[model samples]
Target chain A: MIDIQLSERQEKIIDIVKANQPITSEEIAKRLSFTRATIRPDLAILTMSGILDARPKVGYFYSGREAMSFFTNQINSMKVSDIKSLPIVVDEQTTLYDAIVTLFLEDVGSIYVTSEGFLTGVVSRKDFLKNSIGGVDLNKIPVGVIMTRMPNIVTITPEDSIIDAAVKIMEHQVDSLPVIEETVINNKHGYKVIGKISKTNIVRVFVDLCKNN
Target chain B: MIDIQLSERQEKIIDIVKANQPITSEEIAKRLSFTRATIRPDLAILTMSGILDARPKVGYFYSGREAMSFFTNQINSMKVSDIKSLPIVVDEQTTLYDAIVTLFLEDVGSIYVTSEGFLTGVVSRKDFLKNSIGGVDLNKIPVGVIMTRMPNIVTITPEDSIIDAAVKIMEHQVDSLPVIEETVINNKHGYKVIGKISKTNIVRVFVDLCKNN
Candidate 1:
C-alpha cells in the first residue's frame, strides 16, 4: 500500500470535507483564508490521492473507506515490533550534566541507562527538573543516582500489541516506554532493552492513519 | 450523546479487541497477565457500554462505529468555543526568570503575554531554552523582549472548527495556539485572548474517539 504525506493545508481540507461532505473547493478556501485559485491544486492532489471525490454538482466527499479498512487492518494486526523506534541510551557513568546535554541534543523526553548492554534504569525530563530544583552539582552526579531502577521500570515486549503500548504510556503518565525482552538469568527474569514506544510515535501512527486512509 | 469515562484497563481491553477482533476473553486475559475471571467484569462493562459486541461462538468484536460517528460529529460540528481551554496568560512586563518559573510551575509548553488585557506576544519553552543557553541575566530581561509579536502570531477564532484548530497546531509546530477574537481598539485591530487549544486537546479527542467508537 502506498503511504503519501499530506500538507497541513491539505489535511485541514480533508477535515473540512469530512465534516461537510459535498463541500465545494470555494468553501474550503474560504475557511482556510486562501484564494480559491491557490487551493485548486490541493483539491486536485487530494482527489488524485483517493482521499476525496468530486462531481459536477455533488462537490467533494471522502473517498476513503478502502483507506480506512487498510488502516484498520494494519492497526489491528500490527505488533509493537512493527512500530517501536530506537531508544536513546546512556551509560550509568554518564554525569547528570552530560545527561541534560544528551537530552537536549537528542531532543527526547527520556534516556535509558545501560550497564554492559543490559537495561538498568530510566531518566526523564521531569526527573531532571526535580533534581535541578535543589541546585545540585550536575557535573559531579552520575545519572544512575537519580534514574528509576530496574524492576520498577515499566516495560513492554515486542510480542505485545500497539494498544498495549498506548495503555502503558497513559497509565504510567510517562512520555515513552522501553520495549524490553524478558530473559531468564540464573533462573530469574531480566529484561533487555530492545526499542522504545513514545507519544510521538503514537501521534505519527494516528496522523498516518488519517493520511493513508 | 453520553461521554462515559473509561478505566485504563477497560481502554486497553478495547485496544486488544481492535487489534484482535473475535478474540476470546481467555486470550485477552492471557495477553494482559490477568485471570479470565478478573477480566470478565471489565469485558461485561465494555459490552454494556456499546463499545463492544459478542455472539455465542464468535467471542467479542468492537461495536464502535456508533462511537466513531459520535466523535466525528463532535469534531465536525464543535467550534473552538466548545473545546477551547483556558490560556495561561502573563503580563509582558514579567521578567524572563519569572516566566521560566511560571512555565515549569504551570507545566505548560507556552505562555501568553498580555499588555493591559490585550494579547501582545507569546513565549514557549524552546524560547526560554534558547535564551538560557548563554546564561543571560533572566531577571533583567522582560518577556516582551523575547516573545513572538503579533502579525506573526498564528491564532484561531472561537467560530473555527476543531479540525481547523488541529491543523493550525500541526502547521505552526507549536504545542498550543491561542484562541482570539478580533476587536476594534483605537481605530486599529487588536485581538482579545479568549482561550487556548493544545496538542493534548487533539490527542484527547482522538483517544475519546477510540473509546467512544
Candidate 2:
C-alpha cells in the first residue's frame, strides 16, 4: 500500500468530476483550459487510487473514498489478543483489604474475581475507595461482595478487534474489560479470565500506531 | 490525499528497483518480460505515490516511504485543545474527604489541585485509596498534604499535539495530563489549568478515528 498527497490540480480535477461526472476527459480539459494529454496522468492517478471511477466510453465518476479507509483497515486488523495485558485475578474468598493490597502491588486499575476457578466478578479502584471511605470492615468482607458481578460486567474475547474493545470501554464507561474465554468447570458453564484490555492499553496502541508509522 | 494498493506488477517493479539501483524503465520492462508501454501506468502510480523515484537517465530508486505516513500526519495535526475535556479542579484548602466526594461525583481518574487559581498538585484514585486505608483522618487533612506536587506533575499545553500528550502519559505512567498555560499571578510564575487529556480522552479519540473512517 502507498499514500499519495494529492496536488492542487488533482484536487481540482476531482471537484470537476464530482460536479460534472460522466463528462469526457476532453470536457474536463476544456473546463481547466488544458489539453487531454496534459490531464491524462492526473485522471490515471485518481482512478488508480479509487478516488474516481472510469468507464470504457464514459468519463470519470467520483468514488468518495477517503484517505482514512486505509487507517480504518489497519486498525481493524489488530485483534484484542495483540494488545491485551495480564489480568489481576483474586479468589472470591480473599478479603477486601487483601485485594486492595494486590491492586497496589500490581498497580492496575481493576481486579478480576474468580470462584471455583471461573470468572465471577470485577472490582475497580473506585469500588475500593468508595467502600473504604464508607466505614465498611475491609478485613471481614470478601471481595466477591463488592465486585460488579457477571451478566453486569462488560467483557471481550481474544478474537474481538481492538476497536471493539475501545468501543466497549467507552460505551460502558469502565476503566478496563476482562478478556475471557468460554469454559466449563465441573459441568457448569462459565467464563475464564485470560487477559485484560483497559483504557491504558488502548492509549498504548494509539501511541504505537503513531510511533510505528 | 489518496491511498493506493499496489498491484502485483507494481510490487515486482519495487522489488526489482530495490535490487538494482538506477535501473531504467527499459531494463525493468525487460526483466518483467513486458513491453515499456504495458508497465508505464504501473510505474507512473509507483512514482506518484513516492514509493519510487525516477531520474532523467538514472532509472528508478526505492523511496521506502510506507503507507503509514498518512496516519502519522493525521495524528500530528490534532492538538490537545481539540480533544481535551474539562479539568476537575479543587482548591488546596479542600479537605481530603471532600475531594474524594468530588472525584466520585465527577467520575474522573484524577483531580487537579490549585492554590489561588494556579496549578499546584495532582491526586489520583490510587492516592486516595492509599491514604484512606493508612489511618489518616480524611476529613481533617487538607488535600495539599498528599498530592503529587508541582514540578513533579506531567502537563501539556493547548498547542501540543495529541501524540505528544499520549507520549508523555505513557512515559510518566500517569492517568491524565493537565493542559496548562503560563501565567503570572501575585508575582508567582505558574501554570493555570485549562483542560485535561486522560486515557479516556485518548481512547475516545481512538474510537472516533475508526468510527469517522
Candidate 3:
C-alpha cells in the first residue's frame, strides 16, 4: 500500500547506498554504467524527499531509519480497522472508584461507558482527577455523573483512515477514541462501540514498522 | 516536502472528486473515456489510500479531510530543522517557584534548563507536579535539583527526521524534547540547545497543512 513512487533506477540507487553509503553521484553513475547527468534527477528527488542526505564533502548517504517514512505511508493507507485495539468498556452505573480501578488494572488511559451495548459516554484519567480533587466521594459518584457524553465525544468509524484517527486524537486532546458504528437501538439513533484508537497504538505502529524494516 | 507518490491519473481522479463528489467509478471512467476495468484499479488505489470512500449504494465520496494524510507524508519526509519551534529556556539556578510561574506564564508544557547557554536539564509539568505535591518549599528548591538532567533527557538533532522526534516523545513519555547539537563548553562535553519539539508542533503542522490544503 506504499504510495511513494520510486522508479526502479531510483530504488536501485537507494539499495546501493544502503550497501555502501557516502558514495558520490559520479560513483553511483559509474557503478550503474550511466552518466551522472542521467542519474542526477533521481538523486535530487531522493534527497529532496529526505530519503537520502548529501553532505558537501561527505557525499550522499542513506538516511538512517527510513522505516518511519514507510510507516507514514502505511498509516495513511491504513484504516482504523487495520490497527484498532479492543476497548475497555464499563457500564454507566459503575462507580467512579470502580472505574478508576478498572483503568489501572487494564492499564488504560480511558474507559468507554455503555448502556445496553450502546456507547453512552467516556471517562478518562483527567476526568477522574478532576472529580477526585473536588473531594467528591469516588465510591458514591457514578461514572455517568462526570463522563463526557456522546455527540460531544469525538469518535471515528472503522472506515476512517488511521491518519484521520491520529488527528482526531490530537485535536480532541483525548488519549483514546471509541471506534463507533451507527445503529438503531429501539428505533433511536445510537452508536455501538467496536474498537479503540489511542496514542499507544500509533506508537506501537511506529515501533513495529521500525522493527520489521 | 510530500514524499507520497500519487500518479498523474490518481491526481486527476482526486481533482474530479473534489469538484464533483459522490462520483462513481463508472462515471469517472466515462469522464476519462476509459473502460471501467481500466479505471477500476485507480479507483481502488485512491479509496484504499483514503482519498475517497465508497458507501453501500451511494457510490464514491471525498473523505472530509485528506489534509492529515498529506501532512503525515509531509512530516515523515520533513527534517526536524524544517518545523521545530524555538526553545523556551531557564537557568539551572532558577527557583522552583519561579519555574512554576514561568511554566504557566509561558503556557508551555516544559522548559529547557541551561547553564551558560548549554542545555543541562528539562522541567516538565509532571516534574513540577511531583515536586510540588511533596509539600517542599518551592521558594528554596532550585530547578536543577528537581529537573530531569541530561544523558537521561531524550533529545533530537536538527537533522533527524520529524518521525524520529515523534518516536522519542512517545518512547520517553515526555511532552517535549530539546533539539540539541553536540558541542564542547569550557573543556566539558555538552549540547547547545537550538530548538524544541513537542506534540503541539505535530498538531500545528497538521492544522497548517489542513488550512493550506
Top-scoring candidate (lDDT): 2
Clashes of 1: 2
Best by TM-score: 2
Which runs of model 2 end up more than 4 angstroms from their true locations? A5-68, B5-36, B50-68
* Candidate 1 lDDT tens digits, B1-213: 222345688789989999999999889999999988677656755664467898777799988644332334445787878878889999999998898889888877689998877899999776776566445688899999999998788899999887777766766666678999878776767888999887666665555555443
Cα RMSD for predicted model 1 = 20.8
Which candidate leads in DockQ? 2
Query: DockQ: which is higher, 2 or 3?
Result: 2
lDDT of 1: 0.75
lDDT (Cα, tens digit) per residue for candidate 3, span B66-120: 5344335655678899989988899999998888778767767789999987898
**Every model's TM-score:** 0.59, 0.81, 0.51
Q: Please say which candidate is ahead in DockQ: 1 or 2.
A: 2
Deviating ranges (above 4 Å) for candidate 3: A1-76, A90-108, A124-145, A170-174, A183-189, A203-213, B1-77, B86-148, B170-175, B182-189, B199-213
As a TM-score, model 1 comes out at 0.59
Ranking by TM-score: 2, 1, 3
Write candidate 2's Cα lDDT for A94-199 as tens digits. Answer: 9999999999999999999999989999999999999999887899999989999988999999999999999999999999999999999899998999999999
Which segments of candidate 1 are over 4 A away from where they belong?
A1-74, A129-134, A184-189, B1-75, B129-133, B151-154, B185-188
